[model samples]
Every structure is written in C-alpha cells, then in structure tokens.
Target: MPDRRDLDIGELMTAFDAVVRANASLMTQLSSRAGVHDTALRALVLVSDTGYSTPTEVAGFLGLTSG
Candidate 1:
C-alpha cells in the first residue's frame, strides 16, 4: 500500500480535474471529426451509460421526443 503521508488531496483533485478537461476536449475533437452534433454525442454517452439503450430511451433521457 502507498503511504498516506505522500498524498496531497488538493494536488490530486487538481490533477483529476485536468484529466477530466483533457478527456472532454478529446471527446469534442473526436465528435467533430466524426461529424456528430453535440446533442448526438451526448446521446451516445447516455447510451453507453445505459449499456443497451434504444433511441426512445436516449431521447427520454435527454428530454427529447424519439419521433
């Protein structure tokens, strides 16, 4: 196990935030490259979260109609 004394919560949180921002930036780039709209990318993320979602389910999650 690692030593607790070596841990800095603030620094760890900053690093985590940086990683999150970087990942978001990368996802935006990928979405743009794939010619996907922001809403479509968000729906894809929702579908991934649900593990097996239909268009209706995704639409509902996004407060949209599946029509």
Candidate 2:
C-alpha cells in the first residue's frame, strides 16, 4: 500500500480519479481492438485487483443492474 502520511486524502482521490480516467480511455481503445465492451474490461480489472469478487460487488462497481 502507498504511504498515506505524506499525501492529503483529497489529493489521493484526485490522483486515483485521474488514473481511472486514463485507464478507462485506454480500455476503450483496447476493447475496440479486441472486440469487447469497455465495461467488461473494467469489471475484469476490478476483479483482478481484488483477487476475488461477488456479483453484487461487481454490479455495484460497474453500475450494472442487479435485476
């Protein structure tokens, strides 16, 4: 984990948001080439990062409908 003592919470969130945006942009391009939806790639990334995930968690992360 990154050392949080030297960074402000807001600054960290801003940085994380920026990184997520950049990654999303990249995922869009890659998904287009690979013939997959960007959301699929994003969900896979979220699951991969956490090592394990549930349907509810993935749905929430991807803003997918649970119904």
RMSD values, in order shown: 6.2, 6.4
Summarize candidate 2's per-residue lDDT along 1-67 as a digit string, tens digits: 6677656887988999999899879999999998989899878889999999998999999888756
List ranges where model 1 is wrong by over 4 Å: 1-7, 53-67
Q: How much does candidate 2 score in TM-score?
A: 0.60
* Alpha-carbon local distance difference test for all models: 0.82, 0.88
User: How big is the positional error of residue 60 in model 1, measured in Å on the Cα after superposition?
Assistant: 9.2
TM-score of every candidate: 0.57, 0.60
lDDT accuracy of residue 56 in candidate 2: 92
The per-candidate count of clashes, in order, stands at 0, 0
The 10-residue segment with the lowest total lDDT in model 1: 1-10
**Candidate 1: tens digits of C-alpha lDDT, residues 18-67:** 99899879878989998998678878888788788986788887789745
Which portions of model 2 miss their true places by more than 4 Å?
Answer: 1-21, 65-67
Kindly provide the TM-score of model 1 when superposed on the true structure, using C-alpha atoms. 0.57
